[model samples]
Target: MSPGIPDRRGLWVAVGAFVIWGLMPLYWHLLREVPSLQIVLHRAIWCAVLVASWLTLRHGRGWLREVLARPRLAAMLAASGVLIAANWGLYVWAVNAGHVVEASLGYFINPLLNVLIGVLFLRERLSAAQWISVALAACGVLWLTTRYGDFPWIALCLAGSFGLYGVIRKFAAIEAVRGLGVENMFVLGPALAWLAWIELGGDGGFFSLRWGGWTDLLLVMGGALTAIPLIFFAYAVRRVPLSVVGVLQYIGPTLQLLLGVLFFGEYFGPDRAIGFGFIWIGLAVFATDGVLAARRRVVAQQA
Candidate 1:
């Protein structure tokens, strides 16, 4: 294959992954009948199995052994694993509990959160436009908080957990899929125990209940749903430019917002609309700044 062929393929692959991620709330919604915690447990267990099997098939036993042997790495993975599990559980719960719109809002602000984290913890400098974008997003969030008469705990929690997960993963030594597989391993035991309780306590929906074959299939397929996009995403990042991937990342939350309003019929009154508008403006500025900066770098290199 030509060198450019892989890049072209990766673009499509990345788009597919983002699209899948964007529509994931719909998948979670299908399992709304099952308790969110139970669904999360199943997701952890099944995804671990899938990723482990894939790792073994690709790299043999050495990969797994190596991951386990590194104590420091293992510790980081464990922390990251817990954060991701918490993120997954909460997102699923939010979707099932009809908080999809609020959940979407969290992701909408996540990029800005990353910027904030960079400034606060890493002492990174932001451009003037970037600062303006962050300020607009902050104002949007503040408006929502005041209008609701309370903090948006669900949105904040989702953003915080996922942001911290990214931070931990940044220092991790393992590769992406392998790292996720290892992370899954850390959570597997608790997930299994929880599943056991649900099944043995006669309160489970997997086999004992009369849910239906479709539900069973969907639950089993949750593993694929979880891992496939990550695999596609990993593949894409290796082949595409970071800026391209960055822009595409918005697809997930946008799809989620649409699903929330159009499909789930969640509230989108004028007040929330105004708040989201400010945030969108912030994202527009942030994205435009990134594109312009990237373009300037390219031009400088050419010059």
Candidate 2:
């Protein structure tokens, strides 16, 4: 199913996930007083628990035993595990540092990054419009860096890590839920060991939560949110065309922009405006090209 073929339900669900992710700064801000490392720990631990429970319930203990039996698959998942964990860590850090808007910018650039990855890794070709879009977006980013006297590290890190993760997962070949479950399982040992160390140390561990009761609750929500998106995304990826999914990704960054300006009080500089303007024009060209291309295909098929 392509965007050319209407799908209100899937569109809504995909949009919903992006909305939640965009508004994450609001939720993660509550944990600002907490250490970023502790936040990562909670995200990893709770997300692992949530996915594990789902797997156990759906496939029983046998599936887990099967994962254990496949040593090579386990190793591949372990590598993916680290990549996603790093992505999450970078995101959390960005959210905590009042860089949510920049983080959103990263995602806005991600589709173009995907296009680049396709060209580079998958030997996929981009149209002239697509190449121009990439160049414009890159120039926008560079303009911001020159104007601000520093690079948008958060934006670049978020996009680069995420884009690379998607590429890696493309090669991983595991089912969505199972893949996530395996990735979590691969990291569980190290996470548990870290928690254990935090507990035994004089610094405190399990009970040393900053928000106390609410922290655990939020952590659980984080895990469920983390796991559920993959389910819909996985479902959508299979059922829908890549073009549809690509278009849907913009919702997340749009939400974050609002959050940054409205909630976080980030100033909208003229340079950013110019940069974003370039990006908008570029994407407009790219999307128009896609729409026309899709239409031509449909018309040809009909003829």
lDDT per model vs. reference:
0.89, 0.78
Please identify model 2 stretches exceeding 4 Å from their true place: 1-4, 65-72, 208-210
**In candidate 2, what are the lDDT values of residues 150-219, reduced to their tens digit?**
6988888888888887887788767888889988877778877886787677543345554587776776
Instruction: Compute the lDDT of residue 247 as modeled in candidate 1.
Output: 80
Which candidate has the top score in lDDT?
A: 1
What are the per-model numbers of colliding residue pairs? 0, 0
**Model 1 stretches with alpha carbons more than 4 Å out:** 1-6
TM-score per prediction, in order, is: 0.95, 0.91
- The sequence of per-residue lDDT tens digits that candidate 1 reaches over residues 223-290 is 88999999999889889777677788889899999999999999999889888999999999999888
Window of ten residues with lowest summed lDDT in model 1: 1-10
Question: Against the true structure, what is every candidate's RMSD?
Answer: 2.1, 2.2
- Best candidate, TM-score: 1
